[model samples]
Target chain A: MFNEKIVNPNELRHWEGRIELYWIYTSGEAGDRFFKALKDEEKFIAAKCKKCGKVYFPPRMYCEFDFSETEYVEVSGEGSVRAFTVARLDKDEKPLEKPEIYAIIDMDGTDGCMVHLLGEVEPEDVYIGMKVKPVLKERGEREGKITDILYFKPS
Target chain B: MSVGKKDISCPPEAPGTPLKDSDIKEKKVTYVEDHPDMRYAWTAGQAISRFLNELKEGKLIATKCNKCRRILFPPRIFCELCYKPIDDWVYVQDTGTVQTFSISYIDPDARPLKEPIIVAVIAVDGASKNMAFMHVLGEVEPEDVYIGMRVKAVWKPEEEREGSVTDIKYWKPMEK
Candidate 1:
């Protein structure tokens, strides 16, 4: 019943397809307040658990430990570097023209930390426990994203 | 353990403030946009390889199952009903009868189109009963196209064909 066989691999056919897609992500409840405050007032906010007093940076609506509701509070947006790394390659595995320094900054008034790029200093000069403060974009150019704060530099 | 504990009670209003769609449009809240480059290559195996090759030559081909005496369009190597290899390749008529159709006013992305397009499931003339494939209709008004309407394939010029489904420009109303 079966008759034809394509012995040469080149005789087989193939079709090209692509997924042309774009996506938008909304920063949820606590994020809306946090990013808005940063973009509008140049202020930082943290969420504190109404029950246990644990504070969260990049604020959230509820406490992770006990699931209690949380409320927003203002912070100074200054912190100390807890850890650091130097990245020499871009996401596509190509060598970057300039290496970037990134760090996990432990926010001063919260029990939470944020990972962000380091600026205005050389990679060799960065160290753990170095004080750093956020550098925001020009007032008229802010977009209310994490990128609104351009990077962190030694205060 | 409770040394620093203070009185705690649930409040009527929850902590989070909800924003509306306008908030996003007016830049009242933050959002992120991302795009990724993704691609794929689909192999057209045994049956489809021959079918597409025939289509490139301005012909339509199908498979026949001896057990069921059925000719299947969009041909497959195995008969689904009998669970056996198909017995032969058969050429079907480029002409078909429209089984059902729709007038689409929107494009694939839900954007409005200036001119409505008629799309239909057409039962090829020489294939087994109710064996139909989806294709767009052309050269006829949306109001005039209906079920049981006879149609014929409108092929692109041989030099311009690239062995894809679009090789057939579209199906048009067949002349009596």
Candidate 2:
């Protein structure tokens, strides 16, 4: 404080400026296909087990009970919101830039669930079993991903 | 080859420079001093484990329950029904059928290993349904492996034998 930083090392710029950054995220399968159908072709896919006759929402390869292979199935993006919650943190448990509504949409007539973002609702109004449909992302603006629909709202 | 023998002499290795990658492996080694040691010996089930152990010596093994009169493979150490301890051993062929398996592109630690390996669960001829062992598979494409395909052990050279499962190298399709 007494030396006044010695004229700041005699440089015009004293700090590093901002720069854009990017990264490639490779989601194993469910995440990969969810966005693929949503953005690229506007589709939703799920895995169905042929032996057990039960389907999984997140999708899996083997049946934990008997260790059998799971059959893949394409789901019609139509469904209703079974349960919803507000997610304020990222997967890393860090505060996200913007809070989003996460809903477990019980797919239409299927014994399964799909967790996605919910839009156009206040905090107090999201009920346990509300009817909702997938608001698909426009084809022109789509990129084959979960972000395509933007968020699930009232059908 | 001797089992766990420590009498052999060894030569000194030449010292080398540091390696590029120095990742450490984590193998949990634990011991219980306060509690009594849980001992398990194949002697009671001589008809099973004995023969399986002798396979390293190029022999097969099996056992029959005196009470039930059933030929048990992999050497059943006890009568599963009556709960009485078993005490016989017999021999069986190394030949077995492949149950199911995955071509692991990743290693045990979830890392990309040197090359893709075929890890399989093979059901031995004398073993019961779903009875299998985890072993390396080879000599065919990953897609060629089927649930019921026959496979046999391809042993390593005799001089390289260490009386361990690794001595069998990897299993390959048996000649039809």
Candidate 3:
């Protein structure tokens, strides 16, 4: 038989540590095409399955449902706001100086939608099914990133 | 008319270009990078809670299991092997022997440090054989550190003491 003694609550201890590392992401095959087109030509490209005729924004090399190869197709990049939210806090839960409006935009010619920030519009004015177009970064300042298409503005 | 891989067919258009490493280096392919900041607080439960408190007082402690007769350093409340609660807390010497060591030229982030650091696993005195905890070895040259070298803890000033492994500034070579 063992006897146990209660410890004082004030004596509990804890240690602190932080995850301090950076990550490098590689855009894959279809992403490579989509980003390169957006970066160099300021064009939007989506993948289309010939068999099902389903087009995907943020394209992929293969179709998800049928597992078939897809072909690249140029798109106007205009889209409609499908859903949205206004974020007031950052990743660390710190309050932002200004709230940011983020939206899911359903691209005109694709079955998929892109989640991106909404610019040049007030949060209350945003609505589902509103027409919008991408406002790209200046050609000289453009990096091959999603940020190259800065945000979606009312077209 | 078939299902699975046998029925899958590709479109007539060509797939996207697969870039070589040179293409990426030449800015042909586009990519993005991001850094995420994450933090955590870990609780030093039952046994280690007391052990760390003892460390703050400039003492070393261990938990002993009566059945297995094994004294564990960095003490735990329960014996993992015997699957029972530890019998008692034992005060151990602040002395230990270096089990293994490494001379690190870089910090945890892989960046070079101004002066290299020597870290080691020290098998604490009075604990069962081979039970060790990692700590930095200081007050001795890197070349002088060796396996089986006896060392003693150098504690922080009483006023500076906090219940942490860092309470012990570092371990130094024991005088002959």
- The lDDT leader among the candidates is 1
Tell me chain A's TM-score in each of the predictions: 0.87, 0.62, 0.86
Weakest ten-residue segment in model 2 chain B by summed lDDT? B23-32
Residue-wise C-alpha lDDT for candidate 2, range B36-98, written one tens digit per residue: 344322222223334434656865466556676665655555668656755455555677888
Where does model 3 sit among the CAPRI classes?
A: acceptable
**Best of the two (1, 3) by DockQ:** 1
Error of 3 at A68 (Å): 2.6
Q: What is the TM-score of each candidate against the true structure?
A: 0.53, 0.36, 0.56
> Regarding lDDT, does 1 or 3 come out ahead?
1
lDDT of 3 at B103: 97
* Global Cα lDDT for candidate 1: 0.89
DockQ of each: 0.34, 0.00, 0.33
Ranking, lDDT, top scorer first: 1, 3, 2
- Per-residue CA lDDT of model 1 for B101-139, tens digit only, reads 999999999999999989899999899997889899999
Q: For model 1, how big is the CA root-mean-square deviation?
A: 9.8
Off by over 4 Å in 3: A1-22, B1-6, B10-20, B34-47, B55-176
What pairs collide in candidate 1?
A: none
**Clashing pairs for predicted structure model 3, backbone only:** none
Measured with C-alpha atoms, the lDDT of residue A125 in candidate 3 is 92
